[model samples]
Target: MKKIALMGRSEAGKTTLTQALKGEKIHYHKTQYVNNFDVIIDTPGEYAQTHGLGHALALYAYEADIVGLLVASNEPYCLFPPCSTCTANREVIGIVTKIHAPDGKPERAASWLRLAGCKKIFYVDSKTQEGIPEILEYLKEDGDVLPWETKPEADGKKRANELPQEESQ
Candidate 1:
């Protein structure tokens, strides 16, 4: 299975994004599907610095072909963490969450996250499903850029929704 771990503060819509990607309502957990060449392991949301969540993240990365880090755009401190620590392994792609807002611009959001620590960036609305395909394409392109075989701890993705999640307590 290609493991994709979602990270954010609790209730940041990490779970919601995964469900929306599955084309389901935001009331379910642990759905599966066959992709071109991935088992697509989607796990429960991981809150920052939780040992269980961290362990789960490490385990998932250890088995992941790629990692997708989701960041809520509306959060004022979105890039405050500076970069994705787990993604330092170099396989992490980022998604800027809640792309559409009355005053929020996704392009600017994407740029900020890219600077935070992402070779590839996408803007997506987990609630409304905008930019999902674009996010997929970006991931595919990143994969294509990689060698035939990829190692673990290589990719990281997180998500946030409504307003972006605060970085620290």
Candidate 2:
């Protein structure tokens, strides 16, 4: 699975979203520091709320395969610039959380993410696990065949000829 690094504000539900994606029960846990998990990297909301800590996300991005810029549907302003300043080599995606909020504005939040340079965006409600499957599907698709990877068939084994030259030697 492609590891996801979540970037968002304190109330954006980054930790809850991580639990939802992992198929765990939703629970409140204040993220004080960067927590590296098997499939997700949960960062403190201060990283996005504080301008000084914004650059730190780039350094953390190196530890994950995907960088997810999160925006809650109820957010009044865009934390990200018109275009993403992230310098990570990996793909950047967006996640709009708290879509179930009464005052949530999914459309507006999605627009902000687009302006932030997210190639793909997902809207999810962690509490109900709504829209979570789509994210899982996307992550699965990412494993299909990377540019430098060899395609694997249904079987559990790879043919000798299918191995890369460097590995074959």
lDDT per residue for candidate 1 within 1-169, as digits (tens), equals: 2345555544445666766655568674432221222424454443343555465555666565666666676655552256655444637777777766676666766676676677777677787778765654444543242322232233532222222247433
- Expressed as tens digits, the lDDT of each residue in 1-169 for candidate 2 is 7888999988888999999888788989999999999879999999988989988888899888889989999999988887774556889999999998999999999999999889899999999988887887777653354322354556756644487668779
For all candidates in order, the CA lDDT equals 0.56, 0.85
Model 2 residue runs over 4 Å out of place are: 141-169
Model 2: how large is the Cα RMSD against the reference? 7.1
The pairs that clash in candidate 2 are: none
How do all models score by TM-score? 0.59, 0.80
Off by over 4 Å in 1: 28-46, 49-55, 83-87, 103-112, 138-169
